[model samples]
Target: GESVGLHLPTLSVQEGDNSIINCAYSNSASDYFIWYKQESGKGPQFIIDIRSNMDKRQGQRVTVLLNKTVKHLSLQIAATQPGDSAVYFCAEKKGSNYKLTFGKGTLLTVNP
Candidate 1:
């Protein structure tokens, strides 16, 4: 059986600090993982992605780490700012499937 979704987690951070959000996937067959950030009243936006073949991938002000051994994924945001506050989600897809299974999202709040 596969997990369809998860309970949302909340993360609070101070401005100028770093934030780390973690996600766990139930499907080990999933090869592609993507991170998305969604602001209030807006759709999810692409953040970063990593393949199972790679352990880590970096983007502007963001880093994604994948641990296939534990079916875990994490997103690290550098220099947390108020504008960076959003709900972040991790999505996984396997093979040629166009559908992505999304994990529980984490709401990040950056306080000044």
Candidate 2:
């Protein structure tokens, strides 16, 4: 099935550096967006989210931006640490749908 995907399959960054992960979604009608970070064994943990009505939202040490014009979404992490290394994914829900279509995970590697 068609779904969202990241431009880069993996991102490499140094510790304490700001990390920006970009995602491209094909569905313009998707009204809700979420970013998740998954550790090696755990399930995806919600990092941040944004509604279509808004352009941007922020959480602790993280920010999610929604660009409806280009169907683009990005998650920015501040002061990224080695502990922040994980696979990140973006999911989108269209209308009132309960199921979220997720993008191919982007592996973030933080070098010390």
Candidate 3:
């Protein structure tokens, strides 16, 4: 995913814990959103997606919450592990346009 010019700092966590990541979007017309996970040396892989019509979406070990009013979004990760260490990203799409703007990436570090 493309970085939205601002790169979020990294987060380190212990194993068997939960992690929460947050982002703020600039566009109000964005109709679609997705969360992606990227491990070292790999591109981002889609984790989940939600539409403007919906406020929340979930996936295995992950949940996304969106607040259109504040243009805020967040991702929650359960069961922190060494393998879970990676970079996470949130992407948004505008109405009828396939172009996507990625939020600053967050690097998650899980301490075993």
Candidate 4:
């Protein structure tokens, strides 16, 4: 089976800084997209989503940009902090059931 993984399993940053998590996927036919923030020992929470028809979307303190041409996606967090430290994942809806294929994971380290 194919798998999605992050280039960096862990990322470190200082408080009040910006963080960027990158994801690379193999399935180019995937359609819908979503970014999730997961704290230690917790389930992932939806950050933002984008459809194949669009290229970018933004949310409070967060932004998601999809580049279908290259099969790449990224999540940008503004003013990252201790609370923002967590693992981030990028998922795509690849089937009729809207099944999500999640990237391995990225741990964000925010230094306060």
Candidate 5:
């Protein structure tokens, strides 16, 4: 995630509650999206993905949704725990290109 003087968005939730993080992408042609979770002092870890052809996909305790019509993407975390506290990014890839444009992530804090 790259930010030009822009602060990342933040979301706070109680442990055991659900968390929803949202991202808006500029490229409508982006056909693939992947979400990554990054903890402090660690690299971003792949969490989930959703293709433009599909509206939703679920993995483990996370769900990803793509709204191509609005160029919007969302990640839903079920039963958020302290381990889930991290910066989550949504990156999009277009066509056959493996390169992705990442959004400035949202910082999720799970309060116990």
Candidate 6:
């Protein structure tokens, strides 16, 4: 069977440094990508998102980049903090479908 999506399982970064998390999606038909962060005992929170029409999108301290050609997506966080430590995941939406396919999460630890 073909893989639908892929993501790193873990990431560690020093406080005050930048963090970059990578993901690869196999569904070329997907048109929307979203990044989410989940803290311990809590639900995932939306971080940032990028549409297929755009290559990059930025939030307050987060940025999302999408490369359709390579079926890759990346999330960049500036000045990582201890509070930023969490599991991050990417979800993809194909066309107008209401359901989203979630990738394997990456647990990020920010060392203080």
TM agreement with the true structure for every prediction? 0.94, 0.96, 0.90, 0.92, 0.91, 0.95
Q: Pick the candidate with the highest lDDT.
A: 2
Between the candidate structures 1 and 4, which one is better when assessed by TM-score?
1
lDDT of each: 0.89, 0.94, 0.83, 0.86, 0.86, 0.89
lDDT digits (tens) for residues 1-112 of candidate 6: 3234556688999999999999998888899999989999999999988899999999998999999999999999999999999999999999989887888899999999
Q: Output the worst ten-in-a-row residue range by lDDT, candidate 1.
A: 1-10
- lDDT string, candidate 5, 3-94, tens digits: 21113499999999999998888777788989999999999999998888999999999999887787778899999999999999888888
**Winner on TM-score (2 vs 6):** 2
lDDT tens string, model 3, 1-112?
3233223578898999999888778788788888889999999999889898888888889888988897888888899889888888889888888788887789899998
TM-score between model 5 and native: 0.91
Clashes of each: 0, 0, 0, 0, 0, 0
Residue 56, model 5: lDDT of 96
lDDT tens string, model 1, 1-103? Answer: 6752434489999999999898888888898999999999999999999999999999999999988887788999999999999999999998899999888
Candidates ranked by TM-score, best first?
2, 6, 1, 4, 5, 3
RMSD of each: 1.5, 0.9, 2.8, 1.2, 3.0, 1.2
Worst 10 residues of 4 by lDDT: 92-101
lDDT of 3: 0.83
Superposed model 3: Cα runs more than 4 Å off: 1-8
Candidate 1 Cα lDDT to native: 0.89
Please list the residue runs of candidate 1 whose C-alpha ends up more than 4 Å from where it truly belongs after superposition.
Answer: 4-8
For model 2, the local distance difference test gives 0.94
Better of 5 and 6 by TM-score: 6
Q: Is candidate 1 or candidate 3 better by lDDT?
A: 1
Checking candidate 6 for backbone clashes, the offending pairs are none
- Give candidate 5 misplaced runs (Cα > 4 Å): 1-8
lDDT value, residue 43 of candidate 1: 99
